[model samples]
Target chain A: MKYIKVAGVVVFLLLWQLAGQINPGIYSSPTLVVTEIVRLFTEGGLLGLVFGTVATMLLGWAFAAVIGVFTGFLIGRYRLASLVLEPYLVALYSVPLIAVVPLLVIWFGIGQTFLLATIVVATGIMLVFPTAAGTRETVRVYDQVARAYCVSGRHFLFKVLLPGALPFIATGMRISVQRALMAVIVGQFLVGHPGLGTLLSDARVRLDADEVFAVALVALAVGAALTALVGWADRTLSAWRPEVTS
Target chain B: MTLAHGKTAAPTRLAALTGPGPVRDWTIRVAAFCALLLAWQLAAQNVSVAVLPTPRRVWEGMAGLLERGDLQLAWGQTAVQVAAGMLLSAVFGVVLGVLIGWFKPVDDAISPLLNAVFLMPRIALVPLIALWFGLQDTAKIALILSFSFFEIFFTVRNGVKTIENEFVEVAKAYCIPQWTVLRKVVLPAITPYVMTGLRLGLVYALVGVVLGGFFLESNGIGGLIYALGSDFRTAELIAALFTVMLVGLAVNLGLHRLENLLAPWKVTR
Candidate 1:
């Protein structure tokens, strides 16, 4: 498997280099993209852009997690409220929040505020259903135990429901992170704001495919790191399952 | 008998409309919607119309776009791209997914590369594609295909992995042909996963098409959105957004129906 992966990488790079050789201007070789990555870090505003993008994404993701989990909990707790709001929530969820970029731009202007808000709205809604469903399932599973113990409402929620639903909420948060990043980038692309998104837009306009790929490589790194972090968190949280039961 | 039945059915239909279950739910929904509209109208009165238009104004803007046929044309173009892209993704994803899922060597060879590609922000690759195909429908469609294919691939692959080996063993013991086993057992087992992929594929397909439209500056709803954004036509922009949301809802409901139709035994949530 290791050899297979290495061989796969080598073949991909060779094919790419070959393509670049055949069409020098149209495609960029791995070497060129690597150099571009170096140039970007040394000469371009790569650090600042990365910081800006990551900061916005993290902030938006944090806000989404809070709001989504809370709202989802309430919806889960109240069956009637869930039923009443199902249509609206589904409509909100179904629409790619990117589709409403124009509204964000109009309301918030083309800035970090716009990007952050867009990420929050877009990713927050995506998190809600998963969280709510997870909470509902967890609560349903524990309802009898809570009733037998005659746990107070607040105690039942905090002691029983929240911990039980944590895994589901985490799962939802994991899904939302990818989407939040997408929303942030798309907002930047649309607004022509500062970030990797703007860098991508500028590179494409210059027909500098190398730079585009270079920035994409950075994005891939960030995405992979975030996904890894989420995976680690998931494993760690699930470890708590045995502890909770005991 | 026909006339009697018609009369009874008509009254029951009317009663259903006025009944508590759907009727009360719909009433609350409409009230919520109206409350939202009222809030927006009030807020619009205080704020700059350019920034936040009144609900009435937005409705007019939508009506204008509908009358001018821009909304329909743009929506039609977007729908066509989404449909084409989704079809390609479904075909390729299912085939590749099944191949990799079934064969260990194939999976070992491909999973690493697929994982890397999947992690990359696909939207960022739009420019590279534009460099190849220009800002045309082909480029848009290709982007959508790339966006959607991996999602289906992963879902189908996982689904395949979870299929019980005993079923395949039993089929083999019964002297079932390899192809027959695949068609009868594997396909049915993975139908739910395929349906899920299809649903996610629909949303991602739209994302790809719209992102392409925004970046490539093509003639679709994204183009209309970009145009509206630039012109600062807030009302029309909101209207266009409303239309997109409606399309999203319609597609979602339609896909759910499709899922139920395809796999009647399993309930899809």
Candidate 2:
């Protein structure tokens, strides 16, 4: 299986290289992309671009995590709140929040504020459902015990509820990270912000396929690394929880 | 001693809170919606009309677009591209997913490539796609296909993997042909997943089409939105956004109903 996977990647790259050789204008091979990545890192300040994009994504995701978890707990703990809000939440989730980018650009303009706001709007609502579902499940399972022990208010919330819901919250966080990355890229791409997105768009305008592929590779690496980091944290933090397939 | 009675009391109280009461639910929903509208109206009054249009202004904007037939034309273009892209994705995704899931060699060979494509922010590919397909409906459809293909592929692949081995063995023991087994057993088992994939794919395709309009040749509702935003026509922009949201909600609800109808045994949320 491992050999097949390795062979598969090699074959794919070989085909790509062949295509690039045939049409050097449109297609970029792995080697060409790597050379371009090196040049961008050395001369183009690619690291700074990466830092800018990642910083925006993380800042927005942090805000989303705080807001979403709070709202999730509110609706999840109280049935009436859940009944009133769930329908709207579901509706919002179904619609691509990207549609609101124009409105945001109008309100915030084409800058850092616009980028951050776009990221938040795109990724925040996603966390709500998972967090709420987790909270509701925890309450369902532990409600009787907590009440019998006279556990209420902050104590019940912190000691009982938070730990129980951490796994689900972690899952939500992982998902949000992916979304936050995408949002940051799209935001930057659309507005030409100073990030990897800008790098991609700049390369495209110059018809530099190699540079575009290099920047895309960097973005892919960032996404994969963040997802892995979140997954690791989730596993470490929720080690006590029994494994249940979701 | 008291714990036993508390347990019995807890369930009833919980049920009272959580159980369905459609009348009460709808009333609260309506009330909440009205409160939201009132707040929006007040906020719009304070803000510049360029920043936030009042609800009535937005209504007028929608009416204006309708009268001019701009909304209809743009929406039709978007709908056609999305529909065409989704159809292509459904065919390719299901076929590839089934092949990858069913055969170990295919899984080992193709899964890595699929995962790489899936992980990359597909928006990053827009410029490249534009270069290849040019600024045409083809570019838009290609973008939509790229965006939506993964959801269907992954869902169907996972669904295929989860099919019980015993069912296949039983079919084999009963002397069922390979084609028959696949048709009767494999297809039915993955129906729910395909439905789920289609639902998710539709949402992503909507995003893709909008992006296509922004970057590629602007001809869809997304183009209208970009044009409105550029002109600082906040009311019409808001109206266009509302149209997108309404379309999303309607499609989602319609797919959900269809899913339930087709797969009555699976209660998907």
Candidate 3:
């Protein structure tokens, strides 16, 4: 059954090639996409494209993490603030991320570095709710014990709340990373920029289905790698459910 | 829906319920927003409408458009498109997801395929849909299907597959009809996952439809936004964005309420 499952993909590619031979205009062969992927790699253009978008996503994710953790800590620490802020965060997080791309593009210009900023704006707000909730929900006794020893702000943050709330931060971060990546892609897709998104856009404009598929494969690899990387980190750091809740 | 400012006062009382002060407690939840509005009003006194249009000017623009009946018509048209697309995705996504979940053979055959395909953003398939369906509402629907089908399927499949076997055995012992067992037991039990799937998947569908519309020339907000934004009419783009955000916010808030009612046990998740 495992072998059969792997064969499904191979069979799919073989069939795709056959389809291309029958009608080259619509279906692109896996061989061609693979060859294109190799070509894209050697040319170094694809690397830049992947990096550009990845950089933006990482920046936004970093921003979201810092702000989200701070807010989460605050919310976890105080009951009133959590109640007040949670509603708005939940309300805002539900909105479709794409709707803001245009406004972001308007505020920032189209193309170049503005696209990064646009991606940040689109995904930054998402981190606030989860982290704040994580913070608010952290155990108070840890804080009390720390206070009894006159724990410094930095010490208390690093020793008590941060470690205790690591699981929440990890979960929130995992959620935000996917969203931030999606926002970056969409921002680049619509707003147009120099990256894998732009490469994909170029493929579309030229109607190079094979090139588009190849570029998409690269993006998929990037997306999957990002997910797996952060996910592994989260799981490793926690090593148990107590650190990162599913 | 109306969780008014007064409800925020519960923290002082709920202190008996819990411990510790939240890290960033504040008097106002949206003070930054209010501050910005006030700043905008003050800045508008010196700014030109053509440049940085005042909040008042924007409000006037919104009012005038509504008064002229164009805004209402546009909103109505866009709302219908979004609603219809969302409904279609929800129905198809759930059905497809449930089928794959309920049947292990199908899940075995299709899960990896889907995992690979979903990694490629739905926007990757927009051109394929456009070529197949052309610049029509159908393209948007196709895009919606592509965006939504995978997420809902994954969630639902995981949901149903993860259930305890004891309940199924109990149902079998009682000789519950297969369909009744599905409806009465399976559906209710997986309702939490389905609700989560719907809530999340609809966002994907909404974005796919709207983004696809930018290139498809539909009469929806996406089309209007693309038209206006591409023209460098910042103010109009801002207006269109506000309208889009308003609708999105409304849908999300509405879903949160529905989720709370349907699955109160899943507040944190």
- How many residue pairs clash per model? 0, 0, 14
Q: Which candidate should be chosen as best, given TM-score against the real structure? A: 2
TM-score of 3: 0.85
Residue pairs with colliding backbones in model 1 are none
Q: Write the per-residue lDDT of candidate 1 for residues B89-126, one digit (tens) a residue.
A: 99999998887887767787778888987987888787
State which docking tier applies to candidate 1.
medium
Model 3: per-residue lDDT, tens digit, A74-167?
6667766666667656656666657667656656677655666665566666666656655655555475677789986788778877777777
Candidate 2 residue lDDT tens string, A52-117? 788888998888888888878878888878878888888898897888888899999999899889
Per-residue alpha-carbon lDDT of candidate 2 for residues B1-269, written as tens digits (9 for 90 to 100): 45556565444644554555665577778889899899999999999999998899999999999999999999999999999999999999899888787777988998988898788888888767767787799989999999999999998888888784847789889999878887899888888988988898998999999988887888898899989998999999999999999999998899999999998786543
Question: What is residue B20's positional error in candidate 1, in angstroms?
Answer: 9.0
Candidate 1 lDDT for residue B9: 43
DockQ (Cα-based) for each candidate: 0.56, 0.64, 0.41
Cα lDDT of model 3 by residue, B50-101, tens digit: 4456786677666665677655766676667666777876787688777777
- Stretches off by above 4 angstroms in model 2 are A243-246, B1-21, B164-166, B174-177, B267-269
Query: How much is A239 displaced in model 2, in angstroms?
Result: 2.5
DockQ of 1: 0.56
Better of 1 and 2 by TM-score: 2
Q: Cα lDDT for residue B53, model 1?
A: 89
